[model samples]
Target: RAVLAAAGGVAAGGLTIGTAALLGGTGKGREPGGSPPEGEAAAAASEEAGTRAIADPVRRAGHLLRRAGFGGTPGDIAEFASLTPVEAADRLVDFEDMDNSGLEERIARANFNLTRLRGGDGRPGMASDMRAWWLTRMAYTARPLEERMTLIWHGLLTSELGKLGIPRTKFMLIQNELFRRMALPRYDDLLKAISRDPAMMVYLDTIQSSAAHPNENYARELMELFSMGVGNYTEQDVREAARAFTGWRLTAPPRVQLPEGASEAERRAAQDAAAEAYEPEFIIQPRLQDRGMKTFLGKTGPFGGDDIIDIIMSHDAPSRFIPVRLFREFVHANPGPETVAWLAEVWNGSGHDIREVVRAILKSAEFNSEAAYRAKIKSPVEFVVGAVRGLELETDFRATLRFWGPMGQTLFQPPNVAGWPGGPAWLASATLFARLNFLDAFLFPRGRPLRVEALLAREDAAGMVDEALRRLVDGVMSEGARAALVAHAESIRDPVERAATVAYLVLASPEYQLA
Candidate 1:
């Protein structure tokens, strides 16, 4: 009860800080001497408000780590803190230079059961494994930005296991690999590739589309959700794009030959095996394709899916739309028009290269500003993986797999075509409780010794509290919160228990809830 009371106090204090930060901004229209601001001075002040740099290196580095990827460890933050913002951004954004063989080896050693097991139910078990696989990568990947970009693409260009079914779950993994491989590709190229993705084809009913009956699901989502925001394109544009996207199909696996005396069970086994071994290839049937000239976004052509994607990429909306989304993901939710306009210019200049846009966002003063720090709430995945990465916890992520559903985020499953409604939605009361419960299960799993080696190096109560705060919350807690944590730590006699308790309190604090 005392622990819960102390934790609640820390949460209240942290909420106060977060709320202040969210509402706080530069005192625009006023001169520093308290005189009424002149026009140039006011403009300069607003500009400075948007582009001001974070002066503290530790906070800046911590902010970048939390936003760019999962939260970093103390060592990771310290290493990044030594570099300038531009240098730090470059290192993370240009992650192809990093050797991730160690992560690959770890994954190999973990040997995740990603495939269907013989004589066992497939989807349920494989789905759990898939979630664990991704959580492991997020926790341990050397190229954090690469995995982060993959996650962004997954949420944006979404396909779900609920629709794909047991036989086709492999397609989800294939799509995931595609996102990782082309994590920073040009926007047009990615659109083109995903347009032919098997999981997307099935999920959006693109495979069922044809010239005579062009399903508008993919076309509508592509413009309204993926590329451009709504009101930028018309229903007529959607119909036209759907017509162009017709005839999309995946190659079927060859029928398995059964023995002359084979039983029903044997036939079923052979079919399952063949389905498991099958690799889908995207193909377009010319007969089903609408070859007639159609108008799309004011351009008249015999447009196919690729042509439609190219035209969307060439449009003005995606220039603003894509960058705005990336900014929201990395910086904060509410971005000003001036900031959006500048990001759009960068997008246009770079020909919609994702790497360049991400690089600009990371290095931008706006991203490292006071407003950007702790301004956005962490998603469930971020909350879990951030804790694992921040605390340097070692696990295969199996035990915590069930917690994701309670937290309102399950891997390979998004609620709808628009993906997760992030930001404030992540902190709903139910999910908040789930998050706290998750800490309980994570910190003190059943029948396992508490793992606090990372925190145990600092033996004293104050030292332990500071260490938890430093790693979990970037060492930025109110004095009262710190004292409350220290008091809780001191009350516990066992060092391991003390370390675990402080860590739990810090993780439960509202400040750590925000990214």
Candidate 2:
């Protein structure tokens, strides 16, 4: 259902990204931005723990969708509600195919997306523009679970060309290829793809890695960021692994203007010739490599790049780390511990099968339990993007890219290698202001199928706060929180004020921001 907009885009009065908010969501004025006291948090935890005592699939599906993929559309929730763990697993791939139907086309379109010189991020848009695309896709996707998995894997198996001063076109090509081909494949296959990627080579300094001047950057990340995680591998291991990845490089994207009726053989030959013939192409300089024995995660033997990947993947750490991450991502952080121990068993048993681990998590009592739903805070990326999708504000996603910039994320530009500290970091006063204001950007005052106020009216207002709470939260809100929202709405006389007040309360509420 690719509906091309006629000439001028969706009208201004209807659902749209509010572009003129001179007062953007910004600042770090949060009232002590950190996790709440244990006692209060634990009580809330217990209440959520209480919700899990029943068999509520819609609730469970919603719980899973919020963290697993993006936000759940009504249809997505219903679809999730109709699945068994195996059925859910089958559904995931089906959804992936559908989501990526126009993916290549969309990527092509994004290349031509008009932009108005957004600051100096090298990327366009105000915030992380891609996140906006991701949010809507998730909101619209039939397979929310797969989206979540892709995101988790992306963080672990990272890539970026801009960070390496590589050409942008090639970088985009690599990104599209990664998601299109390996996103849903086995984690092992995904690792192999990452190892060969031009973007990964540059971003991790692997291209500079050599037989003489060994760059340990990519090697360290494979152990620290990708697989075993921190403290499991040593600096010596990084050095050894760097040597293993010697000779990894890339040919830049082509600048060919093919002649008409080029033969298939001629065209392919041209491509191969282009790759092999390009001058000043990106290439691995292996003179710096240190060929030596490096004991990584207690595996000591002569190792090369493939040997390094084998050692890392065959170890206990990646399998364990994966489930713990999946648990952290799809469920709550403090997942009964026992739940993880069991899931880890399955993950290891299945050769670190991501879908297997995810299926296990989805079926576990812990996942369906109350404690898991509203356990974590939404990353700034999730909050702002979710706001745009929730309001169905479709436009050139540049607005979202712009909005995300101030909130502290730029597409392909993370704050550092460690990535954004998601939870309390997003709750900072300055960052929180930017997040809440993101919703205000979508609220239009006039036209058909209106904006914020119209959204409030269509929803049952008696259940307005409840609906907002459900859309924003993973679990039930406290009585006090509910009362507060209703009270705020009642205090307002104007419909616009009422709607905006309700929205503010919902977004400001503890439930909305937490994952």
Candidate 3:
């Protein structure tokens, strides 16, 4: 285990393990209001609140895991706290949580499935039904981060919807393999995998690329979007790199559907559209790849696709890009130079060991400090799921849909693949309204998977609310937050329901949005 030096933060390991601690009940000694947690801000707030910050380790670990991976149920969070940040992260990066079925099983069940067909459209074979179901099933799967990584990679390497001909099936294949399998691997491997994916080939028009007619889009993105942050690669590099990828179109044949009932005219129109969508494939006249030596960022390549990949991955710029994004995720959006410099050094030195980048951030002073806890404004995806996690909502298929659908988020369906704009993009008055509605909908999760009310009744309302707050917000709510919730509970008759209601209020609060 390669380790980075921790300067006054986490030890060599991220976990601080011991016998698991039991969460306190709402015995009279349990404070009703949530004061700030201990550390810098807590020390300051203590002056005004007249109470010390309570160190709720479980809540702290829960906050860390949610931002690092998917939100955890209360029990899951407790177990998570027992593991150091590295151990917990190992489970996440290894995709250990995603053992629903073997890859072969995943491939077999989805092999011949068709997603959509308008009954009377008379298209030869309909597939919209199969595609929608695929997306929906992925949404409900327990491994949200793996899926989330696939979604991110898809945005970065977007394919056109219409041109994929059998877009639905091909899309599922790329998602299941490239992104899911390589989600936690080194960035170099992921970039090459994207270059090989049939869906990406079609989407980026690379499949049509030939020695004579090179496709530059894939090459341009290889530097501009994927590896080096934009502006590091030149027009000269883009032109030469495109030459490297000639003759790399999709190896798989297009799935031609013959939906019944359509006239010849309708089929012709569809075929025309498909042809246009796939024109690059059939027409990439062969061109000679640049055999003369070329250079990209100081590395010369008498290059083929492999040489181009070698040059691209060896660049220092990507070292900065990968960790900067990772820091924004594990830490917060604006990681100061000190943090990025430290993380970038680790990434570059470790040959882009992704786990190293994650470990450094998790153990850094920032991750555990009071300011870092609950600092990110949860995106719609996190907010919805985190609320369900806090309430221990038993979620099923439709229940999962309600999480992102109501908030105008559709994961892989983000408008135009630049990815649903993160941070401010998630906020709008309308979206905020949807967020509130979504939280209330939780206690009554659509599929009714878990009887949330029954669970809450087992514990009094205020106490359960406190537990929910500890898990969701990392126990950072203000004293005013608790009082406001308690006041809201006064109107409800049953203590359990009132407690659940209060949990809803805290989960819905704006504070939960931050890291």
Task: Give lDDT tens digits, candidate 2, residues 351-467.
Answer: 777667777776666666545545566776567556544544444455555567667655555666666666556656677667556655544323212246424654444466665
**TM-scores, each model vs. reference:** 0.91, 0.73, 0.73
Off by over 4 Å in 2: 1-54, 82-90, 93-136, 160-162, 169-173, 252-302, 335-337, 388-393, 444-450, 453-467, 474-501
Q: Cα deviation of 272 in candidate 3 (Å)?
A: 16
Top candidate on TM-score is: 1
Error of 3 at 424 (Å): 1.9
On lDDT, the stronger of 1 and 2 is 1
Evaluate all candidate structures by whole-model CA lDDT and list the values in order: 0.83, 0.57, 0.57
lDDT by residue (1-515, candidate 3, tens digit) is 00111111113443111111111111112333333244666445423322222246675577566766557676677877787665765666556556656433543554433423232354223334333344544434555556556555655656545556543343544444567667667777777777777666766777767666778888887777677878788898888888877766443334457689988988866754453343222222234434556665666766777678778777778877878877776655667677778877988887887656766766666665544554455577667656655565543324345456557675445565344566655655567667766665655445232345533654554566566566666565546555555555566676646665666566555456554
The stretch of ten residues in a row with the least summed lDDT in candidate 3 is 1-10
Identify the leading candidate in terms of lDDT. 1
Return the candidate ranking by TM-score, descending: 1, 2, 3
Q: Candidate 3's error at 429, in angstroms? A: 1.8
Instruction: Encode model 1's per-residue lDDT on 106-221: one tens digit a residue.
Output: 88887786777343643346667777888899899988999999999999999999988877878898899999999999989999999999999999999999999999999999
